[model samples]
Target chain A: MKSASPLPVVFAAFFRAGLRAKRTRVFILLALVPLLLTLLVRVVDPKESGDFFTKVMLSLYFQLLVPVLALFFGSSIVNDELDGKTLVYLTTVPVRRRAVLLGKYLAALLLAALLVAGGFLLCFLVAAFGRLGEAAAWGELGVFLGAALLALFCYSALFTALGAFMKKSILAGIFFVFGWESVVQYFPGVTQKFTVIHWIKSLLPIPPGEGGFLIFQLQPSPPLPSVLVPLAAGALFLWLAVLIFERKEYILSDNA
Target chain B: MSTVLRAEKLSKWYGNILGISDINLEVAGGITGLLGPNGAGKSTFLKIAAGQLKPKIGRLTVFGEPVWGNPGLFRRVGFCPEHDSAYNEMSGGAFILLLARLHGFAGAEATERTDKALAAVGLLESRGRAIKAYSFGMRQRLRLASAILHEPEMLLLDEPLRGVDPLWRIRIMQLIKDYGRQGRTVIVSSHILSEIEAMTSEIVLIHQGKIFAKGDIHSIRGLIDSHPHQVSIRCPQPRRLAGQLVAGEFVSGIEFAADGGGLTVRTDQRDRFFSALMPLAAQAGNEITEITSPDDNLQAVFDYLIGK
Candidate 1:
């Protein structure tokens, strides 16, 4: 019998469910944080609004918010099912395990993208108030948005693979985001390249040395490598997630 | 009948603890009850057959294909897991619909299959309600609906009737019977002897991760009847009843309850003992109020068979 393609089916089902999830509600509110802060900057000091958007706002979204969102969404792609004991439902279907992982990954990625893009757009509008009409300002907004998507793609895939491999991957994911990404990104030379945030921050419009130590410090990688690194890493992580999901034997209950 | 599922020397374990060990079984069409106490490897065995877990040592196949990593084999197999789990946010209709779509149905066909499955389990009216709002029984029925939604030829149900109300229990039993009548392969697991007895006479008694017995109920019961059985009888005159019953050949020993209101009788021939006791009790002033076999449960049966 010719079976319907499982990827689209799983994607649609999980996407609709994720939209109504309580986590999504909290994220919608969390995504508003950057927009709210940009509004504060616009109100407090109109003259440095653009500078704040480029240096501080970009750092906040790229370094903190985007990766955090990706971590939660991507890791949850498999972790939620494991904890909930709902992986059986997905696995028992006449669909490949890879399809299930990829479908849920896509659904999660889309949700994360929407949240980051929506907040970034609102923040961009407020920070670039008068210069909104200029192509340069819009062009900057496009670059930041592109970088945010790439970051989410790469980080979420890594987390998804971690989740598929281990039950308590979120703990490790938090350490990576707050610990490794935070500490390693500031190590001056080649060490910063070890972090995913390095490739992401390299793509930002804000030049290095402008945003102090917390933001970018050294020369960014060439634009081609910046885009390719995250893309290639994301693909590799996603492939790993699919491999782990397909082969791993999950023990759902302690009922022996 | 051709075999639908086969496990060859299949074994699995969690750490040092065993799940199922060296299990070799072949099942054909019709209902076969997996009878065992909790943690007897029923769920573990079913999970392996359903492709939820890979066997540590050996192989399991459905439709001549390895169950693990064989998704297409599910097109002819259905599994209702023991755990009470579902996406709480999604409505029942949506959940079943998603599974139907996964089975390759689309558009109006998927909708029809979903509705038919819901209706079969008597959840059609509650289809729009969120699964979290469902009672334990309703969730169970919903899980049943999910399994049968695709109308697979082989069905594996792990404690499907658990937490279901009496009314729904009978309905679900009838539904399972209907599945068997259609010549479909159904392997239903339960710790309750009568529950399995009610569904099918063919049973595989599993204990401590091994199959203790496999046959019709009559044959297994014959093996069990030979074991010494304790029958607790509550009577007004326990000493008098014990005196009248102690002389029988089937009566092995007798113990008086601490309360002095009941007598426990150990009988080598349970059927013969009951036959003699019925006439003796009806005679006069023997007035037996209650008669219960504490060891009637599957656990006690396993213990007796294993010489515990």
Candidate 2:
């Protein structure tokens, strides 16, 4: 019998399963928080809606939602299987470990993307309601979506690699998201570039002072390099996740 | 018969605690029962053979190739783990179909194989139900279905009959016996002597962290059956039962209960004593309430075997 490619098979199965997952439902609610805030701001102060949207996008979507969503979803790609003691089923199959990890990673990445995108679209439509005819408003929305996608990719890949390397990666991922990304993005000069958010922020159209408290003393890099760094970093992290998954022998339970 | 699995000086330990130590063994194409008490390294040995674990020392191989880090070997191998785990969110059919596709079956073939496997385990009727909705025995049958979906040449089952009802237990035992009849290699592990005895005769005894013995079941049964047995019989007339039992050649000693309702009988030959006790209980005026064999446990058998 001819062997089918395991990557697509695993990806399709997990993707469908992921959509119905309770965690996905939770993430959908998390993504909607920004849109809810956007709607509230538009109602209270119509003229200041644009500024409110920008700050919300930066603070909630970019700074919080994207990375946090990526962290939970990506880390669960392998960690959930281990905790549930279901890794044996996947690993015992004839398919390669890399195929299993990569397939599950793709499902997580797509799921996280959908959550972020759905919420961002709603927020954009509401925030840009009056400026719907303006082409520039649509362009700005495009930039935000692109930046969100890149952020999700980089953070998800990094967390996926961390998940494969260690069992309790979520706590460490929380530290990385809240502690490192939160504080380091505001650091001065080259030190700020050490954070993933810095590169993600560089892709945004917002100027230094316009981002309010979340964007203090910001220095954005060139758009081209900003895009390239995250893309390259995401690819590297994904490759690392696959490497660790393929070679590492995960002890599914306490040695019996 | 060809050796399908071989372990050479294999030793595995979790830090200070040992799993299996210096074990040299070979298993051929037949149903070989791994008999041991809990925590006796039976699961550890099966895990290594199933490629779920790596040996800390020496080596373990299946089909003349190393098991660890070898995914391709699974094409010919099926492993039913001891743990009760499954994708609770997925239906039983979906889980088995997913594994079938992973094993390289496509489209109709996958569905057909999955249906056949589920039917074999008598789970076809509940295949559409979510795993979490199923009872423990159903989940166990699902696990067994997942292993047999592809009809691999070798199967490693760790306590497969656990949580199963008596009716299904007999059916599963017959199914495993059928697999052995097909000349396939099957290694089944269980803590219960009779559970293993009911499946196949070829047995391997493990204790602590080492293989105690490996041979046919009768040899081990001989050692176990000969062990001193203590049977506590509760009857309305204790003195009558004890007086009758004392004359039997198999009776080593007898002690009557202080309450005068029962007596604990120590016998060298339990089969003979039980055969003699049945007639006495059936006789008029002698009422037997309960007959309990406290020393018939696997631990006692192991203790006697190891001590001997």
Candidate 3:
């Protein structure tokens, strides 16, 4: 039976499952990825903490850990069921497949948000430690955190859509992360706009005229376009997730 | 009896393999045994009826509504799938409660329903532990509990008794019969003939993706009884046994095994053949050690029916 409004139930199920995850322990080490870079920057040149902070956020959070974390959480929303053979419980229930996809997608988004948010906050504290109550410092932190959240939502939704569409979406997601998003975000002109990280990097407080390996190498789109495109595209991707999940006929056993 | 399920030209196939071929059937309210050998399209038929799979050729309706992808029909239906699966992370109690809540039961009533189902299946004591910690038999019973917890009107059980203990098996069978008494429909599938026989008389025999027969067990039994019966008798005095057995009018053919080992008799009238064998063997110096029916299995009966 097709259930009415099954998304909430699916979300709650995934939320509970995520809470029970032992991966929270692993997340501590992951959160340290950005923190470790900050520690290295302070020991080398304590005066250039802000410059190093932007570099650290781009290299660690945006380039590596953010997308990696989103991939793990989002892909597992559907992949966990297919792998564990536990999707039968949800599929057999009269709930709409959209609700199942969205609910689990929300759960993955929240977990990814929590992980990135925690890491983002810690990196800020370490970078600007003892630079208390500076409006400019806090403003830059807000932009960075906001960009990270938007990036997480967009990338995680993309991965979740990939998961709903295919069983072997993990390999594809890894390729997108290492091959596409990582490589394309650095390309000059409009090509960088094609990557989620490009828009994310645009929203950062780094001025366009700044000279660095990232700035001189990659010319980003305007900040407004960067933010709106991924957001709009994320919603579209999420919609496609619901569409595919609702229509897909997932066979639980070896069909006779 | 009211018709609980109706299928019209229902068929399903996966790739080159036929899951279940063209089938038209009506099931009235009671325990209806769906008997078939392994890979005989039993699970496929059940999945279609339970709304798990779509029909490739025709239609299947549970209580008049098309079952596939229809969640509203779930209010009246409960399906216990053949696959050994459960949310292993949730405790037995939590799993039952989740289904009950899904059915819109409130806090106290949901708890009551969950408790009743667990107690009914004798899993109340293990309610606190995770399902993954459960034994295979307990998980099977837990699956049953989840199905019944919502008090669904039509229960579809695919191999419900697999890996169940004898005592619980009897209890579950009784519970099914009780549901039937309440006028709810229950369709149970199993390879075990005696298991199906004990639950209810009405049955649907499926063989190799086709409906071989659909009727009561006795009616099917009559078919087997009417078939040329083969009885083997291993005795010390084979000549004496054959002498008494061949004299009967029902005994059409008889042969003694090589080395004068045992007697094999084919007869149209099994009752008369047995009745004649008893008296002749009872006489002085008549020694009978073993007797067996190799054709007692449903498959053998089905094969005979098809061959005929």
Candidate 4:
């Protein structure tokens, strides 16, 4: 028997929905926040801006903005379907539920990436002003973007998994962002490596030729494990998200 | 006829709440009205049949194959949900066309079908409008368009006529009737008895998720007829009218109004009593001013049937 693929259909449906969604505007604003801060840092102190770029901007991007974006974008992917009760269209189709989840996940990830990466590029431009020819400047920007993308994938997948498995996932997502990730990423020793932000901060090029802090006190991790851990963890979380979304039955309304 | 849909002792529950219980039914092609008051298992049963939910007990099948999680079956089945929800961002035409394409139509065929469906539902002119801008009735019609655009053999419509204007209501009803006449299966649900009566004689009366009655309308009427109906009439000659009505074989009892202007007549035969009352009121000497039935109210009728 011939089976239809659901991925493209789900992707298209979400893409069209996201285009006209009011929330996209808010996401755009969120993506611009980092650039605004970077601009402020640059304007206030033009020449002595290296420390601000390495410590403050890096801390803000890795420790704060990325996970918050992931939390909002990922959770909304499933929660939106439940809220609008539009999930019936996808659920009733001949497609497996996993296809529906994964498709929506891809769309959400893409949208989040555009916002985060777009913001990161703008901030990178401001932070690296007048350093166009320097290898260190371009390298810093590349590493920051790479780390931000990985953080988005890992955090979004974790939250997406939570969304698939729970109804009030937003509350749990908030706690994970503010309570767990914020607190866990700061713990000293190997335990800090368990948090996604640790891997992200480890890959940055700033605070170069480091002692403990980069340029100031921004510590970087060993390169390979930093890259590999978040990637593997993200894939694992994404797999869990697909599994739960496929199996869980979501009741949008009270039945007779 | 081959049983296109079947359920055997099917039951579903949510925690301590009963979603639907002990439903056994078999249906084939043509229109079948699932009639019940609000909160009756009509929506639940249809949702399960549409493969939106799983039955906790027994089984449900369409085309002799189990329906849950079966996407292949959707090629032949379409559903219009009761809730008024759509991709409000998309243009109405795009929504319908999207569904048509999902059903595997290609190129010009999908566009043709989408146009035909919009035209059928009186939405062709508003096809370019965002669904959010459409009125409730227009949205209702849009939902209908989506369901029919795929040209599924079986369409499950939950309150498909809801929020629709009268003319469109009749037209939409006719469209559904026409689908049935074409040998396609349609299960339409509504809380209004007369609405279902007007759509199809074949009905399944569901109450609290249980299939209470399933057969021709006359059979269900027979079950209800045994429960006497109270018809109140106000006229200048109230006592005189009551005297005349009590003699009928259908009238089980009659009571003259204490206000001296009406009479309440109880009859086990609603049709026969109405048939006789028409001519009696038209007689030259008849001075009947008003006629009403407390039992004619749907809630009272439902209560009487449940033997409350």
Top model number, DockQ: 2
Model 4 chain B scores worst on lDDT over the 10 consecutive residues at B290-299
On the 0 to 100 scale, the lDDT of residue A153 in model 2 is 92
For candidate 3 chain B, the 10 contiguous residues with the lowest summed lDDT are: B289-298
The residue-by-residue lDDT of candidate 3 on B122-224, one tens digit each, is 9999999999999888999998987888788999999888877555777899999999889899999987665688799999999999999888789767666
- For model 3, the DockQ equals 0.16
DockQ of 1: 0.56
Candidate that scores best on lDDT: 1
Clashes of each: 0, 0, 7, 7
Q: After superposition, how far is residue B47 of candidate 4 from its true place, in Å?
A: 0.8
Name the candidate, 1 or 3, with the larger TM-score value: 1
Give the candidates in order of DockQ, highest first. Answer: 2, 1, 4, 3
Question: Distance from true position, residue B222, model 4, in Å?
Answer: 6.0
Off by over 4 Å in 4: A1-5, A208-220, B222-297
TM-score of 2: 0.89
By lDDT, the better pick of 2 and 3 is 2
Candidate 3 per-residue lDDT over residues A1-256, each given as its tens digit: 2322456656776678687776655876888877888878877888887677776566678888888888888888777777766665666555666666788889888887888888888878877886848988888888878888898888888888898889999899999999998788777667877788877777777866573765435665687888898899889888887777776766667856
- Each candidate's B-chain TM-score, in sequence, is 0.78, 0.80, 0.76, 0.77
Q: Pick by TM-score: which candidate is best?
A: 2
Which pairs clash (backbone N, Cα, C closer than 3 Å) in model 3?
A1-B70, A1-B71, A2-B70, A2-B71, A3-A94, A3-A95, A7-A99
Candidate 2 per-residue lDDT, tens place, B200-237, comes to: 99999998879999999887677888887777777889
Quality of candidate 4's docking, in CAPRI categories?
A: acceptable
Pairs that collide, model 4: A94-B71, A202-A221, A207-A214, A207-A215, A213-A217, A213-A218, A214-A218
Give the lDDT ranking, best first: 1, 2, 4, 3
Candidate 1 versus truth, CA RMSD in Å, comes to 6.8
